[model samples]
Target: MVHSRVSINIDSWKKVSKANKDQIFKEIHHDYAVEDNIKKPLLKKLGKMHRDWRNRLRSGF
Candidate 1:
């Protein structure tokens, strides 16, 4: 079976879904304070993605 698309081009930072925004914050929170979590590296990656996404919106993508 074919899976539906998971992400779409967001035209603006304000347009990004709350779920996606929360996902980023959760990753950052997990990295800085969560106990026993082994995915710290993902924090940087997620942050970069979030920043890049906002940049893309600022660039009028």
Candidate 2:
């Protein structure tokens, strides 16, 4: 199967005005905090992965 690439150009922001930059930064920070909140459960799952891996290695899996 082939997958198409999706891309964003970060340097395009250089052409944006200062007011737009501030607004974008606020939105970015808001989204980041929301994302961190949403990822709490996934972070817990990651902790479990590490614990499971340790147990399997200890048991010579």
Candidate 3:
């Protein structure tokens, strides 16, 4: 079984502090050893993932 490197639960994304968000990004980057050139794409992908999760929760899926 594969396990996630970072475990963060977003009960209220909007209420998440900037510091917490930064910590999440930092952990992901460190875990993946993301290249500087790919950092932007990684962030974009994370955003899309978050949006999809939020949409699913909102739609009761």
| Best-to-worst TM-score order | 3, 1, 2
Q: Which parts of model 2 have CA positions greater than 4 angstroms off?
A: 1-36
TM-scores, one per candidate? 0.41, 0.40, 0.51
Q: Candidate 2: deviation at residue 61, Å?
A: 1.2
RMSD to true structure for each model, in Å = 11.1, 17.2, 9.4
How does model 1 fare in lDDT? 0.57
Model 2 residue pairs with clashes: none
Clashes of 3: 0
- List model 3 lDDT by residue over 1-61, tens digit each: 7634433344357867978877786677677776767876666677668878879989999
* Better-scoring candidate (lDDT), 2 or 3: 3
Model with the higher TM-score, candidate 1 or 2: 1
lDDT of 2 at 44: 55
- Which lDDT value does model 2 have at 40? 57
For all candidates in order, the CA lDDT equals 0.57, 0.56, 0.69
lDDT of 1 by residue, 1-61 (tens): 8643334233345766878867755655554675434444454455567678778978999
**Residue 25 accuracy (lDDT) in model 1:** 58
Instruction: Please count the clashing residue pairs in each candidate, in the order shown.
Output: 0, 0, 0
lDDT of 2 by residue, 1-61 (tens): 7643322232354556878767755655455565666655544564466557758978999
